[model samples]
Target: MDARYARNIPALTEEEWGVLRQKRVLVVGCGGLGGHLIDQLTRIGIGAIRAVDGDVFEPSNLNRQLLSKVSLLGISKAKTAAEHIHLVNPDIEAQCVEAFMTKDNVQALLADCDAVLDGLDNPESRKLLAAACASSNIPYIYGAISGWVAQAAISMPGDHLMELLYPEETVLGDKSVLSFTPALCAALQTSLCVKLLVGRPVNTGTIYYFDLLNQEFEIIPFNNR
Candidate 1:
């Protein structure tokens, strides 16, 4: 166990520790957002972690993905993230899946998780994850970025935040994306998941945007319900 996390989490009461013990969080896509989310959650003392990412490390990932390193290239993202978490906090039960999540693996991957964190790169994958979470009645913290802009939504089961937030197919298409955007979105998604685990509600059921070029952060609530 790292001294920092042990000191930061403090000594929990039996009940408090019990709450953390039962939490199983599944983080999909160990890219930029997933890397940072796993890093933070493991440090915060989450009981168990299931990290999934089909992608291997590449040179392009160095800028934002936390787990990417020159020496780590060609390694599995999930494995790298899991190893890092263990080094940071041995108490957390971290598992890594080297394959991408699909219809076949969605249920199995998400089966025991109390919450699902989406760090997916494209809408197709995001759609699949969202559908799985919705059908399972699990909450999905979704985030995406395109260039200088980022968008995030906290989709509870049955809410379908993406559909509500972006009804236009053109807007939801692949053309809208930026490098820095996903990093920002992932940060928000991770924050929301942590809040949920800590027994808090994030009232902003909307898409949050961060314009790095303009240096503006805006929360746009979708009252479509």
Candidate 2:
């Protein structure tokens, strides 16, 4: 365990640790954002985690994906993420799924999760996850990054939320993502997940956008969501 995590454990009371331990989290896309999110979540004592990613780590991914390194090349993202989580805290339950997420498999993958983290790289998969969460009426924490910009939003079912807010085409823009952006976005997503689960104010119903180059951070108001 990291020294920082040991230092932070006292902040979590026995009841609080129990609450976090019992909660299950499903993390989709174990790439750049997913890697960081998994690390943070596990360090915070999240009990069970499901890591899903079909892609294999390549040399190109080493730049941003923490699980991708020279030695891990050719390994599946899910495998690397699962292994990393165990290294952080063997007490937590971790599962690695190296399959593409379709509408067919989405529900089962999401079945027992207390919450879903959308670390997916593409908008189509993101929308699919949102739809599943909507049908199940579970909270979905979403984060995406492109270039120096990142955006995050939380959608709860019955709001007709995600589709109403971010249209399919706009949300799923066919653009490449830069590495550093996902790292920052994933950190925020992890923090929001912990806060939401621990009865803390997560500032839900808002999309936060930050530009690393300009050092500007702004929140988009979506009170209706």
Candidate 3:
């Protein structure tokens, strides 16, 4: 076992840890949740990551984005994700797609990915990503964070999780987020993804909701459409 992943023992069996080193995942968006997702995925020894995001970092992101810094204010988030992942684990292949997730490019971005991580902040993009994942027959590990709340769910193929979660497409995104919110949500998402890729039992269509300010957590089970 590698020294860096030595702590993964007990929580992960040797076989499971080895499985992680062969799977590739696609992460959409590279800001708050996306940044932490890439960081954790790399450290835990994911074999490869396809990071997609066309946006550049700004001052507003300094508060929560792990890859954002004063000197990197105008840098591309997707490219930065690749750099950070390489720095964390040089063996991990971090592929950078410097483009937003759109109907035109979503399919190509998801190719050869074992799973898709939802690091997107908006509802419309999330819906598009879910649809793409469903079409590709890939598992979608969804995570979202707001001011004091976070939600994580796994959407298997043909599941209506996206439609049920985002019934209203016109819903505007909420920008209010605490520095710790994405970190917590990203951890939850990363764990779920690990379980998924390593053939562990994951409750598809079940949502894990957390309210940090109220110190409450709930497991909400829902039927898949």
Best by TM-score: 3
TM-score rank order: 3, 2, 1
Name the weakest run of 10 consecutive residues (lDDT summed) in model 1.
170-179
Tens digits of per-residue lDDT, candidate 2, 1-225, equal 445456656676556666887899999999889998898888888989999998999887877887788988898999888999999889789999999899889999998898999878766787789889988878999898877888887777755546666675574443656778887898888878877887776776788899888999998877553
- Residue 51 lDDT in model 1? 97
Task: Enumerate residue pairs that collide in model 3.
Answer: none
Instruction: Give the Cα lDDT of each candidate.
Output: 0.80, 0.83, 0.92
lDDT of 1 at 67: 87
How many pairs collide in each candidate, listed in order? Answer: 6, 0, 0
Better of 2 and 3 by TM-score: 3
Clash number for candidate 1: 6
Error at 125, model 1, angstroms: 1.0
Off by over 4 Å in 1: 1-3, 6-18, 166-168, 171-183
Worst 10 residues of 3 by lDDT: 166-175
What are the per-residue Cα lDDT tens digits for candidate 1 across 1-225? 345545545444444545766799999999878888898788768889999998899988887788889999999999999999999888899999999999999999998789998878777787788889889888898887766777777888777776665555735444444556665677788677767766765854677778888899888777764
lDDT of model number 2: 0.83
